[model samples]
Target chain A: MSTTLNPGERPTGYLPEGADINRNIAARRLRGKIWQALFFSSLVIGLLALGTLLYTIIDDSFGYIAVQTKIDPEELSDRPLAELSKEELIEILRANISAGLFRRFDRDEPFSERSKESVLQLIEERVIGREVVASFKLTESLLERERIEATVRERFPRARLEFHSWLNRDFLTRPMSSVPILAGVGNAILGSLWVIAITMILAVPIGILGGVYLEEYASDTWYYRLIETNINNLAGVPSIIYGILGLAVFVRALEPLTSGAAFGVTDSNGRTILSAGLTMALLVLPLMIINAREAIRAVPQSIRQASYGLGATKWQTVWHHVLPNALPGILTGTILSMSRAMGETAPLIVVGASTFVVFFPDSVFDKFTVIPIQIYNWTSQPGSQFRNIAAAAIIVLLVTLLLLNATAILLRNRFKRSY
Target chain B: MTVAELSAVDMAQANGRYAVELHNTHIYYGSFRAVKDVSLQIERQRITAFIGPSGCGKSTVLRAINRMNDLIPGSRLEGRILFHGKNIYDPDVDPVEVRRRIGMVFQKPNPFPKSIYDNIMFGPRINGWRGTKAQADELVERALRGAAIWDEVKDKLHQPGTALSGGQQQRLCIARALAVQPEVILMDEPCSALDPISTLKIEELMLELRRNYTIIIVTHNMQQASRVSDYTAFFLMDADRAGQLVEYGPTEQIFTSPNDKRTEDYISGRFG
Candidate 1:
């Protein structure tokens, strides 16, 4: 039955009565625009945060660069200053004003104008071949080598200098210095390397073996279930707890083997590299075990059955078929765990890692300080210069972490199998 | 009902030679029985098929023959399973050695995550078969050919076994089983996960395998039982919490002319 519609509700040609096509299109466009705006805004926020962080680090680090200076070889070797009486030494410094070695203040010049620390620094850099000054000519002409040498000689006559930057050979060879210019990370670098080596050696085998036992051998009874639950819970436990355990057990309980003052130190406190390493190992042990268990569990049960069906013993199946398939995943997990151990500081601190160590650890029992601890120490100081040192240390740390993560990712991608 | 009646009955009908003999076998999981008082004879160099509805003890009986059921926790078996005229469950018999002689292929194809060549060589290597590399290679080729998979996978033998299609993977598994030269092969629905073409290929492979190795297979497909097996055993769930064999005979007799009415109804698709 056909019915007549009211005049206000009449349908247009080739259109459904209730449809508003333009409005629907507009709504769809509005949703698309909103999504686009959200995506762009999120990206902008991320970039802005990154820029602010970088700006802050650079600004703080600039003060350290300003304070750092190279010691003039001639000044260090000056015998006249040592041999002369105090009155003669002061007169000699006054006579070398034209050489720009020292600035002499007269009654006419203001205190600010008479201060020559900055100018002396610039002149020393030029004399030492550290700063390059370009010579401009009307035509493109190379200055004669002799003339260029003479020009440099005329600029500074009293003192001989050498080219040096804030980052120099001494920065890599020397230990942390009270003088900012002489500070280096060589000791900390060695300490970190030793800690990581010992941590991996201690953690990997124990973690892997425990994982194999839990996943392959142990019955799924209440006892094994309890162990599994405890391992997962341990993974979430704070790193500082492991430190306390190491301090109490390895430091005090096993004192006979690890506590002797063989390194010419009298303190019986367990602040050795071995103690810190063992503490770090305990911190990441549960992480390694949990990841390894997951990797082993991911191996298909069918493969195990197939091996067993071939008359291969249970051990044979697990060793040959199951373990090989799970190796890549295990390696990935291990690398990630090692990365955590590498960067961990809280546990080492609790275990008494010295923050002011000056020498490389000669043995596992020697006191040590790692890069993070060194940076942490530097950051706690009152001067902004030390904060810059910490920032530089952080850059080194981030680069090291990046290299390790890249290697892990590369290994995982290289050996990844579909099965 | 009595020893005298059983002995009298045995004396009247003990003529045919059997490769495997299961006598009053009962299987249990913890306190629950899964197969009860099952007795059967598996003839030598023959393809035997066990067909039934889900959880009817077809696979359980098949696993019991090779002592594969021992792998399952809490599983226990009563009664005797005699292989080569000796009790397979004897305390002196090593399960590993027993399994070496009686290989198994599971319902799903499970090729090792290894090169196709390695998957076939794995069994021999583990069993301490010392031979020249050339000899091992030749054996791998022969085994693959025996399973009718050599032609398709010959050029790609170095590729990972898991890279093959499902059907090829199953054939590779069969070849791996054959590599160890088992006396009896147990297949638990070996072709259930395959397509029609692969299933027919597997059935043909079973028929060819019967000339050398005794094969026992469990299948849900009724047509497969009629197409390939020489002997057929029909199992049905009984009220005593375990499955019982309703009938066992030549394949033609079981399919076209079953003695038991239950077997006939199941074969005709009237009821399962």
Candidate 2:
């Protein structure tokens, strides 16, 4: 407000002189740069953490392994064991193992019914008793291949060094086992599907209906406001708390319903797929309701007015106009919630999902274990082989999540209409 | 004689004389009164225009005719808005039925994100229209034709109504209202959002529609009211900021020889 002039002629917004102005501009520029750098660094840090996670998972998923056998295959066959015919392999397996063991294999799946590859696998598993003596990560396998081969040859002459990808067809198809090489995520994958299906079945309709009621029908009164506030708060509550609630309600109180006892079936208890799904449903219900509410709220008020002006009833307006306009957004939110339910582990564990389920859940009443729980179990085992399998399972979970998110994106874009 | 003077005689000869009559109506949002006591009769099958400045409650009054204000929370109306000699505000009278019979076109074109055909059919479908496919198509065509937008949209009837230009979308919305066979059409600044050409088009369409349906339009433009309306109502906000009707008469007299000083002042652009 200063100027070198008479008071009557003084300017209202006078500039400070050049040097001070330049300094101020420079200081502002420097401050802007600092904030920009800080924001960029935060982004870099987040990306670096995600990059490290992916690198470790990939590193553990493939590598080299040294396997040793108790009985040499050369001693059991004249030629290479891999070159032996299925009959020769079976004969060698019969001659080496005990009579009762061979009889048990026959009784389980008669030799005539078994495939050649199955017979060879049985022979390698039972007769040869191949065991992984050492394992190396993907990076170490490539960088120190010669050293690994030398160490394997020097330590165990019968050991065979080979490159192995933990995420193989066999690992995906075989049932879970105590033996690391024989373990697979097949059963866990099935359990995850069943649990998620039931979760969606229970949560989706209820969550959407609740959202519609809140957004469209309910009056803006203290109680409805209270309900809205509690729903918002419930979405942020810890998932494990939901698990405890599910345990008390679905597992203990509604045990008969969840255990299939109400339907005249009673072989299993309440710690079944239905119970796990119900728990996961409880964990994701708040999220679903919040997202659905947001989607429904995004529908323009003008559309509702237009529908009502056409002499449509409240239900007709919501069902025909509001719902169709909100569908894409609702589907996107639902799928995102489904992905969240797919990856949740704490709630399922508290609801009693088994850590080592070998059998697939064929019904809602059967026992279940999801992929994340399987990874958790594997990572805790005292072996690098288990770590590799855990990494593979993590890859599966990531792929599933990615696919679900992709579907959400596709549905949104495909149905997105400009108004 | 001018068309306005001729219609005045036709208005006298009509059996019912009026399509709608408002008896000392006052509109309120919550406790705040938006429109003060006002009463007027709308001649059957004629276009009536409400001209006023912004926030003068002209649109509010127009919406009250069809009970569109019911959608707004805490909005209430006092006195009676009569249609077919029955007060529409009666508890036994369903707001939905009133809306179906007295349709509205909004200030901005708000066509649903649906095909042109579907947009027109929505009103009919919701009203339990039980027609064959061919009959449905005929109904759509008649409604579109009634809005004077049939040719522009007939080729692309399956295209989304929202994909049309602003003016076309507005016409589509009018067509949608017509599909329900409403006896009255309420236009709340329908041409305010359109270009001059589109505004002229809508004005012409309103004149055509007046042959079969009673029309009430709220507009800020005085010329538009004088051009299209058989009867014109002028409103101005009072010291309390509540809108009150300043004058109601034939459009020609209201413009040329207004009885109220405020109407003359407003028409002469002295002040709002």
Candidate 3:
């Protein structure tokens, strides 16, 4: 509060109040430096946390594994198993297993229709009976190669040690199996796709229109206030609660509708993709509505005034001016909501995602299991190799999320407005 | 001048002589009366300037003409505003239709964040004026030309309206209002946000529009009122703070001759 205007005539380092101005400046600079350092450290902490998460997942994704087989593969064939023709592999599979099992395999899917890779997989499963007895992390495999070789030679003389990438093509294409090596995330991937598609279809329009009604059409009545309060509270409710609600409403109470019985496809019970999708839709609906409201609210009031001044009715004003301007923000909200739905496990679990689904869901009412649930299932298993496959599934989920977000971001940018 | 002074002859020919007439109109926001018991007649195809100090309810009265005040919560209007000898406030008359026939340009340039072509097309499209491609193009051209901005924006019709300069944007808003083929255009200080050059341009444009459209402008500048307006209504806040008309007559007489002492003082820059 010094009002002295002739401070320049005084000593250069001192203020009119006889305080050392340079010291004051230095102290302020020191405080700024300390705060900057604190901010930088916080950023580093966040980055380190993210790095550790990705590292652990990737560390378990690829490494060396010791495999022991019931029979020696060299004794059965001179060439590698992968190079075998479909007919040869099918013959080998037919010769090793029981005739009843062979006939069952043909009943499930004809041998002539099976590809070479699938037949080789079957022969390796039914005949060679490969078992992963020991696995090592990527860092351990890289640093302790000689020790891993020695351990394999001393303890499992018949076991072969080879570098393996758990996230291989076969892992992405095959269905779930008790054997970790044979398990793939194909069914889970498709289930996630189906559930997310249904979630979007069920949630997006309802969320957006609900926002419009609240922002544009609804008056400040007590009932509307109550609805608004409930929506805000619903956004904070646990996802598991939405799961229970979906279970009661879509799975049990409306089983006739959700299980496809009402549509004349009566094979499935209530635990279906539709129920899981509905649960996820409920879980994200509040967030969607909140985000849409924010986007719509961000549109300047003058734009609405301008539109109304042009003789546009309320509906026309909302449709032509408000919605188009709010589109980019709504799309951003969808991206965030979609990412949350993709990674969510608790709600889908309570809504009845099968822990181990082998078949792809062919309809909305078919039994399904998403990738996060699959990861949870794999991580909870007793075998060490299951962790490796879980890591691979995590990678798949992350990539799918990135691709989905990229598409949404591109759409948001396309419709972006300056005002 | 008081409403009772020398108005019998004007009231006799009110319907045929005036494009719009206010019969003791009172505007309110909630319980607060903003404009009180104001009466005036606006001649057809003439520019009528409403000059007053800030917050004297000039803008509110302007908005009340086309029912624009209905957008604000708790705002109500009493009495009647007549257009073409009919009370526009009649229950059966839709506000949307009222706004279509009497368009408005705001104090700030509020062009939509769209192409200039689309900005003009918005009014007609919302009113369900569908036309062929060529016809639509012609309409856009006519509206832009009518606002005197077609030549500057001809090559850039597809550009965003917001990309125009402040003055061009105001002109574009005028074009947007003109596209609906409104009978009257209410301008709420259309030149206030512009530079001097842009203000001159809009004044000239307003004078040009007087030939085909009835224009009502709310301005704070006395020179603008005297220069562009055919008739001027000077308003002042009463002791109760409700805005009331102090004088209404030809712009020249309101500026040069004496009427109410308040109008003379305001014109002479003594006080608001």
Candidate 4:
């Protein structure tokens, strides 16, 4: 250190002169600015990547497509299907399709008594027999209209070139179809809801109870310590491993119980909604327990002491004070684990989530297909025609995830406000 | 009191004037003996103070009274603590019942993170109070008034108890202990976390509470003990790091003419 002082005088807290100080300050500021720029660029890059992903998903969901029908819907019906009477549409359906297809429709729900919406749906389902031969993005459909018309004329000479967004209202309501244009996420949505519902029912109470026992009741014995260590380690295990375990335990070992055979429904094997849900529950159980234990442990020890000092029994203290305080945290963990379970694929695939089921799940014993499995099935197909439907399915999965997360956040905020 | 009479409680009159008697009690946490051979009587409707430096087992002995020590893992006690005349540690005797009759306030103001009304009502509610809403309201008001914090918190009864100031929260905790109408109340350094004004306020509140409840306090502040307690017990950490009672007497006599050199040294601020 240097100071401007007389030679004989002792220097105190010596400092550099102005020019050198300015140089040092300038260098420090330059370093800070460089770090700031680096960090800001990293954030922008991350946001850009997310933006690109979201853009791709949305781009694939909506757009115009050229559809060719076996019998022109216009030639089959005089007016728009929406405006046609149900009986009129039924007459057109009777005139157009083969007798066997017509009989199948009637068997499912008789066309004679079908409502206007049902008839419209029926015409879309079988009478028109529309298959999207060519698809275009929103930008391409808007900009290259002449080119699209030319291609339709050359490829499917009788096909109508009309604007069609693949992710329209009907896309959410229709069942699975071998034809990409006819397929919808209705069955997948219902299946996912069932699987998640069953997973929640099985995992939440059991996981939370385990957390409470481990954190509050269990003695610090070697057995309990072993259990704690195993639980923490189990959270890191692969999802496919859980699937294999589920196959062994719920499928093979407890086949009678999981297959609905015990309930006298012998048609379904062990690969049912119940089995898939149980597998998903097993996949997320370790996550649920770890999160719940952390939440419970976060409650101040003094609060427990306060309850005990007030003459509350151990269970009373846990129920009245501890649980209420830790609920938000528990729910947050559940939300994270549930979302993870919803997005998981390998485990469900291993546990036999159907890829081509046409029917929505009517019972827990029914074969099911969740959104992730459906998306995987669509994306893995050789034909590029399934891309639009796959994208639509992906959007559905993302929105469902967003909705669940939003609800969890809302509940957590409400709890935070109260406490 | 006879053994049979001790088991029986007169709800209207409370228990005998001698609220608790510790007979050669030793407290241990895991193999370490924290407090050794402590014998004392905490009188009913009076304030008793246990005064000593840190690590002297004052809090340990205080926790021994209500079996609060039982919650600490590996914590055990030898000998006995008798409430009225019955040993609280009896095999069939329930610790929950002992805590009900004897409430406690901790060192820090640890009001439950709930509404002020709920904080006060919790003890009563958990104990299976099936009283009407009006009765519950009256109990809340009476308890809050007993702690001398009713006027400040009456308008915001639904507000979280933690929102109150340090002094107000401490009083709220005291009100919570009072809500169950416990016959005896134990305080473990109730004012160490408070400012001088709050400390003085708590000291005065303790004096008032002594009229209706048996109060035992463990304090590090020598002046606080002299100011608030009717009886004083001084403890010192022995050679083995176990706490032993050095002197016990009327507060006035103990403060003026302390019998032990360690007690006098402690009072004179010579060494801990």
Q: What is the TM-score of chain A alone in each candidate?
A: 0.68, 0.94, 0.90, 0.87
Q: How much is the lDDT of residue B49 in candidate 4?
A: 93
Question: Could you tell me the TM-score of candidate 1?
Answer: 0.77
Number of the predicted model whose DockQ against the real structure is largest: 2
Model 2 compared with the native: what TM-score?
Answer: 0.94
lDDT of 1 by residue, B1-272 (tens): 12244335435544436767999999998888999889999988899999988888999999888788888878999999987666778887777777887899999999887899999999999987899989999999999999999999999999999999888999999999999988789999999999999888888899999998889999999899999899999999987758889999999999999999999999999987
Q: For model 2 chain B, where is the 10-residue window of minimal lDDT?
A: B1-10
Which scores higher on lDDT, 1 or 3? Answer: 3
Query: Model 2, residue A203: displacement in angstroms?
Result: 0.6
Off by over 4 Å in 4: A1-41, A70-129, A142-160, A417-419, B1-17, B130-134
Give the poorly placed runs of model 2, Cα more than 4 Å off: A1-13, A16-33, B1-14
lDDT against the true structure, each candidate: 0.79, 0.91, 0.90, 0.87
Model 3: per-residue Cα lDDT over A273-374, one tens digit each? 988888899999999999999999999998998999999999998999999999999999998898999999998888899988887778998999889999
Residues B141-232 of candidate 3 have per-residue lDDT tens digits of: 99999999999999999999999999999999999999999889999999999999999999999999999899999999888998999999
Best by TM-score: 2
Q: What TM-score between 0 and 1 does chain B of candidate 2 receive?
A: 0.94
RMSD of each: 11.5, 4.5, 5.0, 4.5
Kindly list the per-residue Cα lDDT of model 1 for residues A1-419, writing each as its tens digit: 24566667756666522557777778889999999999999999999998877665544433212111243435533663344444443344454345444433333453345334433433344333232222212111133445544554676443333222333456556688764544777788889989998899999999988888888888869988999999999999988888889889877776554555655556645677787778788888999899888999999888887888888888898899778888888899998998898898888888788888787778887888888998889889866456656766776676688888888899988877776
Which residue pairs does candidate 2 place in steric collision?
A: none
- Candidate 3 - CAPRI tier? medium
Error of 1 at B174 (Å): 1.2
